[model samples]
Target: MDILMIVPASLLVFILGASIGSFINVVVYRLPAGLSVLWPPSRCPHCLNQLKAYDNVPVLGWLWLRGRCRYCKNKIAARYPVVEAVTGIIFVLVFLLFKVSILTIGYWAFCSWLLALSLIDLDTMTLPNQLTQSGLVLGLIFQIVIGFFPEGSSVGAIKHLMMGIVGAVLGLWLFDAIALLGSIALGKTAMGAGDAKLAAMMGAWLGWKYLLLAGFMACAVGALVGGVAIALSQRRFGQKIPFGPFLALGAAIALFGGEAILSVYQGLFFPVT
Candidate 1:
């Protein structure tokens, strides 16, 4: 990890990630409201005044402005810089783990999609199809592009592409099937088709085996959280718990830890002596 730091490159990557995060904030705010993300640009929600260039420099801008709109002087939400910082950290992690490869860029995109979608779902309880479908398409396209730059990696691009396709199909069908069964059992909308689509997007990056682990983690954690909320009287009976956040959490853990855990499982269950 220390060896891959590459201070100059990592700093640049962090800036790039923060910029992407700023764009994500735009998408999250506009997409749910049926507004074009590009048109209005960054502006104070209160004053409707467009932000100046210096006032929109990711984390630094928020600090410099003291979290107030320059023109209107309206207090800004702290969430903007928080999102930017978290995204920068996530990007740094991806770079450290994968180094400077096309794969690293793909993972960066994967993490960004998950982060943006998670924020939107947390806010609106809906996962837009546009983002998920775009992620799915890009994931497959990355597999194709990676073929030309194998770099002696173990997983060939073609095999990875097949795995991605199978993983996506399985994720869609299995999650939807679970949702159907849950609705039948609970007599309400337990989960929506958006979750199934999100699963497909995740599977495109995680592959089938890792997707299964991530799915299990999501369901298990979601149930626990719901139980805790009920116990604390924070949620009413039969109220919906947004699943996208838990899914993102699971995907993060799977991306970082799944390979090691799966290897241990294989060694224990199918020991080669």
Candidate 2:
């Protein structure tokens, strides 16, 4: 809690987050390929050369190597470092916002999952059940555990758990309903089952109120991005764009600032106690 302590803690959190990000890269690559994440160690895809300890040192390793495989001189994607940096930044932000708390740790894990899911969806247009389903289960379990704690039960623990359950169900149903309506309007499939499951996972973490906020934000951002993509000729008018990334973005925003944002909106519209 001391300022001096805060500085050291933040640095430690960032380093730990970057390390986790390195592992997440493995999950992103192997989970999609049905490969064991642990059986084989990290390797350069182009050369199949096993990465050395120095080569696997998060962001610094890539920079030190000039983004090339040392053994084969093959180019490594910049995304590797970017992912590490983003994860590090997010971890620091979580610490700053929540300090040392259960919520901080929970949200840190949630963000990591969200980051992996977003990238996977962008690359493959799919959200794996392994991630989303497990995330939902984990979220529910976390909420239930928190619910039993005295600090968390001021508003009734059972109510908290039920909210999570309702959130998941509502999120799943909302996405499915939209998909059905979109299919009817477009005369084709408009969304995938993965997205619905993803929504449920997010809802489990965020609960019903914030989940709705996330959904609204996702729609707004998705529309804006879609419009821009069409204008830039990056996508055809009728082409489908991945929605999971936007949903992930929305959930993140809601997780970090949903209550503050809602307060601002309420103050603007109601202007009354």
Candidate 1 root-mean-square deviation in Å: 2.3
Report per-prediction Cα RMSD to one decimal. Answer: 2.3, 1.5
Each prediction's TM-score versus the true structure = 0.93, 0.96
Give candidate 1's error at residue 196 in angstroms. 0.2
Kindly report which residue stretches of model 1 are placed more than 4 angstroms away from their true locations once superposed.
1-5, 151-156
lDDT of 2 by residue, 74-157 (tens): 999999999998999999999899888888888898999999999999989999999999999888876886787756564566
Best by lDDT: 2
lDDT of 1 by residue, 198-261 (tens): 9998888888999999999899999999999999999987899789989888888899889997
